[model samples]
Target chain A: MTDHDHDHHHDHSELSELELRVRALETVLTEKGYVEPAALDAIIQAYETKIGPHNGAQVVAKAWTDPAFKKALLDDASKAVGTLGHVGRTGDHLVAVENTPQRHNMVVCTLCSCYPWEMLGLPPVWYKAAPYRTRAVKDPRGVLADFGISLPKETEIRVWDSTAETRFLVLPMRPAGTEGWSEQQLADLVTRDSMIGTGFPKTPGAPS
Target chain B: MNGVHDMGGMDGFGKVEPEPNEPVFHETWEGRVMAMTRAMGAAGAFNIDVSRFYRESLPPTVYMTSSYYKKWFLALQDSLIARGYINDAEVKQGHAAAPAKDLKRGPFKLDDVKRVMTRGSFARAAEAPAKFKPGDRVRAKNINPVTHTRLPRYVRGHVGTIERHHGVHVFPDTAAKDAGEHPTWLYTVVFDGAELWGPDADPTVKVSIDAFEPYLEPA
Candidate 1:
């Protein structure tokens, strides 16, 4: 399998028909002066590089290493994340849910795609898809299994349905054998899926 | 109104397929749509709730057929027309019939994009004291208005406990109607999985929803 396949499950050979339609629509809108190309690039660049999953990874790593920061994150995620310079978009009222040995947390926006964009960036394709939206709440374990995550049988799963203004971020447990690791090292272990509660953080010495 | 967007307990959509090495966006058009939606939003063409209502109001077939960005494109088209930014003729003909009207400000500049995105309006305002507090029993009202609403149909009329108050924020039901913010207390309500999905659900799973106060009543 290719490196891409190893990262995620699905593959698309070419752009779909809907994508072509959107292209045409965009061209028309741009020509009509309703959208500015430079502005588009700016917005895309901000989410793509400057503000994304890495921000959340840093937040997770800090929470794992610092007890007081973890308490602040759990108490008022919006204000705590702001202290780390991550704030905006659906992140005004943030709530950090910690995943302990006994309770696992997962996030899904059933009504709409209300993600913590400033911290986690734009949500992944699956997070916005219909199946994940419905199944995450209905069959939590089954959904986790699809993502190759299997929690202990006794662990209680709490699915946070982001129906209103508050956005959720799942604080995954720190992996074993990384006790003395620095925050930067721990940040590298935190993956995008871990914060979303679809997968776990990378184990120490494991191939990323 | 039970819109197609409310896909909580319903079935038949199939599996959640994660795209391999998915870029921030799939294609150029998708990126454009995302940018346009935000730029237009910044331009004050429409509020977030109105934009959401546009997507929710789409025909079920169209709603299902369109991709995420495609829906945004379609909704942006509707918003542009409704807000007098563009007309149906211009959309169909692929060209503007007349010069676009001069606005107080132009589309977002590249320099201000970062600041605009990071510094979004909170929209939360001080209102009356919350009717319910943490650990209070409440039931989601079953009212299904044809216009925009944040309450999902699956949780309607269901009893759940208020986990915590989320402070007062804009109520989408009135926001979409262009009435006002109609700020209300929001809460995170937790319901037992069995309570929501009946006996077939796994008792170990619990579902929590961020519910606005108007959607809830003392149970």
Candidate 2:
């Protein structure tokens, strides 16, 4: 098949096939009283506004400044995260894997898109796409390179394939030159990819 | 089942495109689909395992081509139809033809949205002592059933070291078939890069998977 043939599958009419199917499913469910339309709005609103990587940044910030919290987080992540009211949905059974100079950690769901929704919000499209799922486990170095990250050959790259219920969160190393930085300032450096182990946290003064 | 969804160690799809400042949902319908799927789960229409099975049940061609939310949309319809909640006519007409079938739980409502969104615990009480512990060597079982299973094909028959015991959790193999939770011990099994891929694999890498007791045997 030509490249044009493959691209044609993604082309859509005025009402895309998926759009029509989703609308139909929602309408029928609403008519049957299985799903409340208002409830759908609530769910959507929460994900869009209330929940996101900012919540995870808070946890990372706390860990960076508080040694006690860091220990608790690294030891029992679910309990530690719950103490901060971040426990919900996919955030259950959370495990925090810390990155040191000698080791790095990355998380993927090879079976499906099993992400820690409560911690980092919804996963990005690339994380769910077939390429990331397929290559992250095999050629992690190449995958890391795609994100413009090149760890030293000495550092070990550990890829966590979330095949079961347990979810993983990467605790990226704290950047240097922030001796007296506040927790909020530290959090501003944490990006979603940093927590996913695809990119490093922004250095001080780097644009977000 | 060895399905297309088990996409570990495979390649040649494309580069990982990172969209800068991507929104939670690219489109309105995607959010609607997400909300509907979550609402049905909250209403106990189906468990996560069963929902996953339906997604895996899609034809390889459709599974490969459909977008993420599209797959969820199709699987949600499949589960709802299988459970008699809605039918082909209802989905096609965009309206219910008959009275609604009572859900396993009540209709997910606005009042309990937060509570429902807080996922319920899948961990169950351990029925017996765990068969494996941290630092123990175990091999992923090679058996592949035509029915639902959580063991990905790539890791099957591969030996790895037990990193941590995650206590007893619902076993997806049986749960997906509506057989029962059949709670079992779960662990984090860490395999070396050379163990999973060949020697050509990046030597500085390792892969870890959350595995149930059923999928492992003492190496």
Candidate 3:
């Protein structure tokens, strides 16, 4: 009925632009004795921190120095990550994929962001997007190449689907010439990309 | 065996290339709803008695229309509403109505919740079943018209063998069930890409998917 209301409605029909619409609709529904808006708001907020993908570099660093610990990690990630103070939720049954000159590892969740949240933290935007999920499986080399992450032709990309129960971590190859580096130093060489099985683990003082 | 999020290299058809464009950037009420959900969990509101709601009442459309978190959220809301933490009418109420009300719940008496969260880590640790032996050849069942299944689309109807019987793991299908939410029989099956995709794959490129028992048949 009002010019202002007409302009506001015309300017935005999409949900992203008009979250107020959700609130408005919730009000109308609730006032008419139908819906409860606060519960919906609470639920959505809980997941916003779910920005997907966390740091992989740190996990790679710990693996380079610890063998027995690494064995435990590969055996069962939930408990193994406890060695580094990362546990619970996503780590229930952990598996560490290896990336070597002969084989490489990558991760994707085609349906949703089923990532190893505790170990890797939140997943990166690209890691959870549909493009990476579909393309990485189709042309693994092409997608990695675009990210400036190329392995030799002989290398194999072992893509993993991270699930809510079972989690994944990439065991990146240790960089050369770091004969005496500490675990922390080695951890620094690992990256989020390497953990996702895209980029190679960085060499200390070596170019990425 | 089958992890909920292990979807990898099937075919390159579903990618939303170049992404989308031309939308004003703002958080939706959906986001606001998600935010409040977290806060409620933080505030210790609601008596959320979660018991794996995936086995019975899993909505058919949820298979494709929802994200993992959305699945989880739906699962949470379903169980909650079913038990009366909030009703359908409550869900319809606008934001800010259900703020830290007098609804007192939660058994978290003295100690922190850190201990309870580890319940999954210690379930049947040694009591779990380990049936299939590794290195045994088996044929994956020819599951057709699979509207709701975790078995990868690429590996179905293909022949592979039990690579490793990684003990008894939780069955997501069952865990996701509304009535019975518990883990089921799980095993890892190693399928050579040549067997799955034929000449398109290198012979050495073998993919091993940890599959639940329902998806297998004896070779």
Q: What TM value does model 3 have? A: 0.68
For candidate 1 chain B, the 10 contiguous residues with the lowest summed lDDT are: B98-107
Q: What TM-score results for chain B in every one of the models? A: 0.93, 0.98, 0.56
Model 3 in CAPRI terms: which quality?
Answer: acceptable
Question: How well is each residue in B27-81 modelled by candidate 2, as lDDT tens digits?
Answer: 7888998999999988889999999999999999988987788788889999999
TM-score of chain A of each: 0.84, 0.91, 0.71
lDDT of each: 0.81, 0.88, 0.53
Q: Candidate 2 at residue B6, lDDT?
A: 91
Tell how far residue B151 is off in model 1, in angstroms.
Answer: 0.6
Q: Each predicted complex: what DockQ?
A: 0.45, 0.60, 0.23
Candidate number with the higher lDDT (2 or 3) = 2
> Candidate 3: misplaced stretches above 4 Å?
A1-18, A21-56, A85-90, A206-208, B1-92, B95-119, B122-129, B144-148, B202-204
